[model samples]
Target: MNEFLLIFRRDFTTAADQPSAESLQQHYRAWKEWFENLAAQDRLVGPTKRWDGAGKVVRNAKDVTDGPYADIKESIGGMLIIKANDYDEAAEVAKDCPIFAFGGNVEIRKALS
Candidate 1:
């Protein structure tokens, strides 16, 4: 089986203007359920992590102070690594990801072995 890295992107702090604690808790609960399901199937590969959106971009030995990456929108809020047979399988696994329901996105890429 091949391993895939699922990059979960979302505007985690977008609700700051109209914060709803209940909604946030529900979203977190859904995220946890997804994690547990992946673990139960033994498909989880590593500890999932959330990325900080504010960071410098370095390319070709040049540092570019940027707030966001051109490649992605909303920023990479979190991620996970999972083992799957193929892209189709990986996509299938991603279908159960919580981001979709929460109006976010999950980008799935094959991990370099």
Candidate 2:
């Protein structure tokens, strides 16, 4: 099996875009269940990590900037790596991601050696 990376993206920067506490809890539960299922199937490759949506970008030798490209409609929120037979299988696994319920997307990519 090959490793695939699932990159999660979301458009949530303002108070209006934030989900309610109950909704957040529900989402968390869904994520936990999904991950647990993957682990049970022995498909989970590595620990998942969440991003705070804040970082710095280096453009040149001395030019630096605070990121996530504020002008964009969405920002990468987190990532997970999983084992799969191929890209299609990896994408199939991502189809059940909880991010979709919140109008987010998942980018599936095969991991390089």
Encode model 2's per-residue lDDT on 1-113: one tens digit a residue: 99998999998867898999999999999999998999999998877777888877676778778786656778898999999999989999999999998999999989788
lDDT per residue (tens digit) for residues 1-113 in model 1: 99998888766555553337897788789888888989999999988776776876676797675756654557777788899999999999999887776677789999786
Model 2 CA deviation exceeding 4 Å by range: none
The superposed Cα distance between candidate 2 and the true structure at residue 95, in angstroms, equals: 0.5
lDDT of each: 0.80, 0.89
Clashing pairs in 1: none
Q: What's model 2's lDDT at 91?
A: 90
TM-score of each: 0.82, 0.91
Q: RMSD in Å for candidate 1, one decimal?
A: 2.6
TM-score: model 1 vs. ground truth: 0.82
Give the Cα error of residue 24 in candidate 1, in Å.
Answer: 0.8
**Residue 30 of model 1: what lDDT?**
86
